[model samples]
Target chain A: MNRFASAITAFALAILAMGAAPVAAQQATPAVTLEGLVKLEKTIEENGKQKVVLEEPKVVVPGDKLLFTTRYRNAGTQPVDNFVVTNPVPDAVRVADESALREQVSVDGGKSWGRLADLTVKGEDGNPRPATATDITHIRWTVPVIAPGASGMVEYHAIVR
Target chain B: MKNARTPLVLGALAATAIGSTQASAAGVTAGTLIQNTASASYGSGSATTTVSSNTVTIRVDELLDVAVSALDAGSVTLADTAVLSYRVTNSGNGNEAFAINVSPTVSGNGFDAAVQTIAIDTNDNGIYEPGIDTVITNGGSTAELAPDAAARIFVIVALPGGTADASASQVRVTAQALTGSGTPGTSFAGQGQGGGDAVVGATTANANALGALLASSASVTLTKSFAILDPFGGAKPVPGATVTFTIQAAASGSGTVSDLRVTDVIPAGTTYVANSLTLEGAALSDAADSDAGTASASGIDVAIGALPGGNSRTVTFKTTIN
Candidate 1:
């Protein structure tokens, strides 16, 4: 696949950037962290105009919006190929939007992945129909490669239901 | 020489985009715990490593709401027992108890009805049975009810004696959450189901409805008399003698006396004279027609419609001995 070829090239580039002298091969490893937060919005009037501001949540109720962010960093000295991040959607909330990354969702508990529009689920009438945000059970992103000491973050939105 | 380095920000930006809404009652239950953890896997040539993030948890808060409705129709009779029905529903997202109040006397009413018994539908049936249903003390609180559950109640009252007929009175029933109630967003700490904070919903946690009772008593009275005359201008009861009958009809009471009709069959051995029927000094047709009075083969018929209280009508007709 084109994606695998690019991953191999990135690995070669990381090796050239390091040095040309003989060196021992090192195992690649990346540190990953995830956080969940709620947003509280407030609107105020200023100079005959309305302005909206967001604050950290003191308490959360039903119908509130939440953000889930996952960050990954390549802490090893060697380049990493085929780096993948997977997150399971919590049962108390429904996915509201996709992240600003190359993302795919799985309706069958992380067994498969594809664009939401390309997926199908069993409907109440016992027929297969287009999958909706409520049917999404997992989300994943596959990066071709992570250069040594490189890092990035991906985030998505969900509604408490 | 040193290799190139990349740095990713540690904290998220302050701004976040919002999304569509879902109803509170249909959402996650109060005090529910939501947990999430994400994992990542990476590999180079011939080696792979997997790592997981720290778990995050969130607790859902409680929403309090209620609704009440009156089940009885418009009115009840004076000096009689009147049973009014109501239904109270817990519309919140947690188990809740409610206090019910039924006020028999309302402002701007003609007369007050005395409350006799307040009862709950123990069997969950919509009807109220005196001995079988549980009686509630006035202004008592109900047992804990689950979310979306409802309770039917009955308030029996007696209309006071000597109350004017056709007069009306109003009764009010109200239900309030037993934990607490106030403006929306008011909260009671550690009082919700599963020990989460309980907050008043858009309904303000309480509701009330009204029912009406009216008095009615109507009556109608009738009297009759007869006189006879011979052909030679002498009073006698003989063959071919004419007998004149007079009848009076009166309506009394506070309610409408509707469709008051007066009819008399011709006695045997007598024949009704042609064109002799009269009502209120007006001549009536012998044929069955539009006039209030009609002399048919069966009898003399008169139709007096909707006679109000203290009103009366008169009718007279002649018959000859056969």
Candidate 2:
């Protein structure tokens, strides 16, 4: 083939590669991004008053209180509706709070959701027993919509088991 | 952040604060990796998309704690070798060795005991064996113990001679984690099982127990007397007179004297009296039998087996002068 035809073919291949890169980037980027963070809850005396604060969990042991926060932001140009966030309690931890607002818990591995008092688990004696905070397996929060460039966060407290 | 919160949260914190005062001995193993992730699903129109957040990872560290308990009874005999037993437990979340320390002398003790030897129950038996039990010196460390495991230890102490009965001595035995010990939360990097950080527990990784020893001494005292009565019914020593011998045996101290017996040899000038032996006003046969007392030409004998302290017995017999 002539040098002019070969040059045109190389240019065509370069344009195709440039077009594929943007499309791949668009597919890889999600319309909404989520971030999960864990922090140690500490009660310190400040000005002779007990104050609660969150710090990096450098050291954690059993019975230590911890806060898990999940932040979601709409990164797309259009608004998204029916937004929901769900998190599973780690095996080594137990939910420390059962009455936190804007949230529900599932003791049956996301099969059903309700208040802790409304849930029951089969006990060792094969009888239905009221579920406790330790029986919580999943936590969930729902928002009707997240407009473009809007962000929101949900959080819960848990203790190492 | 708002200070307004649920009462359960406050209650939990308060309870946990109180719980932290005590040493926590059980929990997840050290160096356990825990990870968590959250998922979010949304719909912009007809299409639904789901995304996951970055995972959060945490590694559980080690907690160091130790406890010691005394297994010895409350009392021991004076001038005797007293073996004080103790159990040392590893109350931590990892395998740890402990250094044993015994203080043979404690404040407020009536007498100080001389520590002879410290030994471990190498075979896991509760009793101490001379050749089998492994003897350890003061401040010596024990073998590595797994979490919640225990080791029996025996501290041999000698009570001082002439120690007053009822005198008490206290010995303190302490077990300290060999990995490290200090204020709670003191951490040693890369020193725990699986190379995780080792942190001191609420017990400061050490615990001690006090063993009490009360001195007991047993003894028996005897007293004898004789009354003479002539044929005219007068108390006098003369020929053809009847001599009544009374013997009393008393037991004292805080222990028992086993197989206690009293025997009196007949006087050279006294003649034999048959069927005259009596114990505590009870008549005894002349021949040696199952009865407590016996009368023979040679002597008068009485067997009082196992005389406990604070008790006494009396024996009496009559003999005619030759």
Candidate number with greatest TM-score? 2
Taking the tens digit of each residue's C-alpha lDDT, what string does model 1 give over B146-241? Answer: 777788888888867656667888888888999889998898988877667888888889998877888654567888989999887887989989
Model 2 residue pairs with clashes? none
Residue B286 of model 1: what lDDT? 82
Off by over 4 Å in 1: A1-30, A33-58, A97-103, A147-150, B1-25, B73-79, B105-112, B164-169, B217-322
Q: How far off is model 2, as Cα RMSD?
A: 13.1
Give Cα distance to truth, residue B214, candidate 2, Å.
Answer: 1.7
Worst 10 residues of 1 chain B by lDDT: B8-17
Model 1 interface RMSD, one decimal: 15.2
Highest-DockQ candidate: 2
RMSD of each: 15.2, 13.1
Fnat scores for every prediction: 0.42, 0.49
Chain A only: give the TM-score of model 1.
0.68
**DockQ, each predicted model:** 0.18, 0.21
**Tens-digit lDDT track of model 2 for A1-161:** 12443354356445535744664465577789999998998888999999989998877766678888899999889999999898876655678864332368887766799877788877657788887886677788898999999999988888776
Model 1 Cα lDDT, one tens digit per residue, A1-161? 22443454356435533532222134222333334344444456999999966656445556666776777777767778888877777666667765412368887767778998888877657789888786667788788888878888766676666
